[model samples]
Target: MSQPRAGHAPVRPRAPVIRRAAGSRAVALGVCASEPSHEAGAAAVARRLALPLLTSGTDPRHCTRLDALLCLDGDDLSLRQTGRRAPGPVRVDFGAAAMRHRRAGGHNELLGRAVGVGKKTPLVVLDATAGLGRDACVLADLGCRVTLCEREPVIAELLQAGLTAAARRGDPWLDALLSRMRFYPGDARSPRVHSDPAADVIYLDPMFEPRDKYAAVKKDMALLQRLLENSPVQSDAGQLLDWALQQPVARVVVKRPIRALSLGERTPSHSIAGRAVRYDVHVLRSLN
Candidate 1:
């Protein structure tokens, strides 16, 4: 006798597929043959991050396998895309001309005012989401002992490399500014960050959703977006805000999009508005 047909059995529901971001996903640590001196540094980074290290005469530009390459290009360690039409490399360069210009132009008047830099004694700032360390560098330039907390390993590596490069330059002004800044490579919500005695002002700059329509996002920002496309923290800015509020700090400052709703839907004590962004100040106690 023929067996009963299996098609009569009940069918189980299929699991939804998890989709990854578009474009190449493999990234490697590459050291150019033009500069043999950077091999050791690149190798160390590769080992540390457990990423593949590409050396020899292999040209990163023509290497079709890698989507991106963390390269030790001469004096700078930069993240460069491998595609022919990719944007330029991105690096955390605190000594860049733009940063110097900003420093000279009153060191970001609004950020300084929002952080209570000149308004009060030199404060200790805990930058909870120190992406590129740009704002932390600014705060340090304004005489605040700024602790930079970055959970992402790649970004922390970039910040460390930038600091190392800047330190080797022996520039007095740059050294003085960097002296007040410290990089903490971990989550800001951990007990390690909360136990920091120097944390007088907790600053949160959680990544906001891109708001511009016609204007192309900045190169560095676009790279960051791609890097953190699948990050859990990307959708948990409210949680970060809530944790910052519970810290034993005199104030918590949140950098937000100009028209976006308040973080966690909780109103700030007051807000300092700028052209493109605003500082939502949550005053817990007197800075006195």
Candidate 2:
């Protein structure tokens, strides 16, 4: 990641105080292979993330010391927790039945409307916080050329693998959607991202601690939360919104929990609300 402008630094968001349970330890992440053929790929990923590599003979779930494992099994990549009580592994699958149903039923209207998707020409979208590239995939399916930017190495690797496998499936309809998507495994706030002057809209889905402590989160989100708890990259959410607002684009859209306050406490030009989430639109100019 590039340093913030010489004299100016990003305003860091106040770090949330986290409390750990008694006897709980920090997350121990590693990479492992479930088959001999996948060992090489697993080893490469382990090297990239600087994580320990468990040989193919070791069952990752039985490795009690390792809290999580990135497994390269067959053609798919997934993240699995070690304990018997742990939730199922999380992986990105654009070809999953749920995503397929959503695409077929045209149920992603809120996201499309938030980004002004029905423009005369397809819009160029920069997804600043492409967690699993799910929204980015939706935008691509909606006819937008989408660029996904993810800073975390582990998450980015999983996302890239998912895209690669989807492409290899040899499905024409899926191919068309994949063609419009590009992955950038780095900071979206970097100067390199700014060099792309073609993006009409920038989308941000800054992750924060869920407000309701007892609320249930999806499996993927739970794992990501655990990973982030140990992650070193703690870029301020406020700084991200600040950066996006300064970008030369037609508009910026931020996804926020419906009850959460506006990002940076700055009022948006308008907002589109759903049952649980809201899209806050900061319009700099008309799409026309």
Candidate 3:
């Protein structure tokens, strides 16, 4: 809940223009009226996103011009692709996945090792590119205090909603993990983030052009890529890498696909290579 310092202003990026499909109709955001409890929340979300609330019996299937649909389904809020063949609804579930990863012993995981999680003292990690917050959740579950910075408004909203739901579950262990996590609403490249002295390590996961032609990308990731493609929010790998290297943090970790080149043509001090991805560790200073 700590706010960024006074002099550190947030970078105001251009707002995303919601695109419409071929037809003339506009995309709508709505709740399933059968679940009346979700009406208020849905309405608020629609208002914030500048989307219209679809009326009862509004058949999304027939809305060929609609590009996307944000719906409150029971206890979950989801964004579904309507006009084209989108992978699936984009939502975050931290409870089950976090617990599973923790139970599976993540100390040996490449990310965990790269982030120096098994050290004597708990590390504070700033996940600068916290897409979906999956990695942040895993790091939190492994006893790291994680500050997740998400620049995209829609993705940030979904992450906040997911964390809220996870906290309400009343699971002691989950609550403990959630307590160690924080959300920041600004670009990772913003001065607000770099000026903060709390984090011991900064993590970057810059999105690169998809190289998988023969293999199917995960549904959630595919959906995320599609949404990002249409939004004004973009990741500048070179700039992010440059800023991170100059930070006072003990180390900077960059996640890259195994075969992809290093960000900005700069190599890490060392790297942990996996079958599909690699964690490039840049040691600014020793944590010890």
Candidate 4:
């Protein structure tokens, strides 16, 4: 989740790009790679992404040939398209309005404790499932070094693009913060976060399949829901939980909505609450 980013528009006005090849339904992270009937412009985007052609709608006839669905947000827009929307509580531009929204029966307080802005532990965060790189930025703003990990390369590219653009724009702080963000595609299984990382915390915002069916969960959250639904069942939920648990960090923070079950079966050592969401804070006394 990206926090407090402003002064620039999103990466593009249209749907983000994704790989062209068709991987497993769950493994593909909810993206469908098929040739678009409108191959002209779609091919261009595909060329730029260097991924196999993906069809969001699943039916080439419904979507244009050049209409490539790159699965940047996890869901196949072609399958169930919800166009880009205004940033809600999860948006980086979240200001008084969003804070107010949270204060007015939303999840804000919990966010505060988990992302303690003034903490002194050389705050390093490893966002295991960086859906859109928002949370990592928030932690960085709070004086933490964050390493964002996303199993899908398509989303990673967009994140990298945003960070690079932020860097070039001469936002020195954000640029320096970008230096702190290293994107890795795939999970802990890919040998990305294998070696000991310089992080005091390993954060997990794994996909939350909402059962409440509340559409008011904020656009960013909804977008993430759409994006990650296609993650392979083999997605490393178990391994990630275990590895993070074993990390030499002082804590492992998992972001979840209020009353929601833990990411995996294992419970957190402790928790912090926001209005709409709650952070399961697992304190690692071994490190402490």
Clashes of each: 0, 0, 0, 43
- Give lDDT tens digits, candidate 1, residues 1-288: 011111222222222112234443323334332365666666666555555667634565787765667787655778777778778888888889977777765437778777788656669899989987888888888899888888877777778778877887889988898878777777887777665556889898877754434224676467666666544344577888888888788899998878778888899999998777889999998886
Q: Highest TM-score: which candidate?
A: 2
Worst 10 residues of 2 by lDDT: 1-10
What CA RMSD would you report for each candidate?
A: 12.9, 7.9, 6.2, 8.7
- Model 3 clash pairs? none
Instruction: List where candidate 2 sits over 4 angstroms from the true fold.
Output: 1-25, 104-107, 210-216
Q: Which parts of model 1 have CA positions greater than 4 angstroms off?
A: 1-34, 105-107, 210-216, 232-234
Q: Candidate 2 vs candidate 3: which has greater TM-score?
A: 2
Model 4 per-residue lDDT tens digits across residues 217-241? 5544554454455433334565778
TM-score of 1: 0.84
* Positional deviation of residue 28's Cα in model 1 after best superposition, in angstroms: 7.6
The lowest-lDDT stretch of 10 consecutive residues in candidate 1 is 1-10
Summing lDDT over every window of 10 consecutive residues in candidate 4, give the lowest-scoring window: 71-80
- By TM-score, rank the candidates, best first: 2, 1, 3, 4
State model 3's lDDT: 0.69
**Against the hidden true structure, what lDDT does model 2 obtain?**
0.77
Higher-lDDT candidate of 1 and 3 = 1
Over 187-212, each residue of candidate 2 has an lDDT whose tens digit, in order, gives 99777766664799999987765444
lDDT of 3 by residue, 1-288 (tens): 332122212222233236333323333333322255555666566555555566433444454545556666545667676554565677777776544565475323878889998673679999999978888878887788898888876677677777777777888977887888888766876777655547889999877654544234676566566556545544466888898888778999988878777778898999998777888899988886
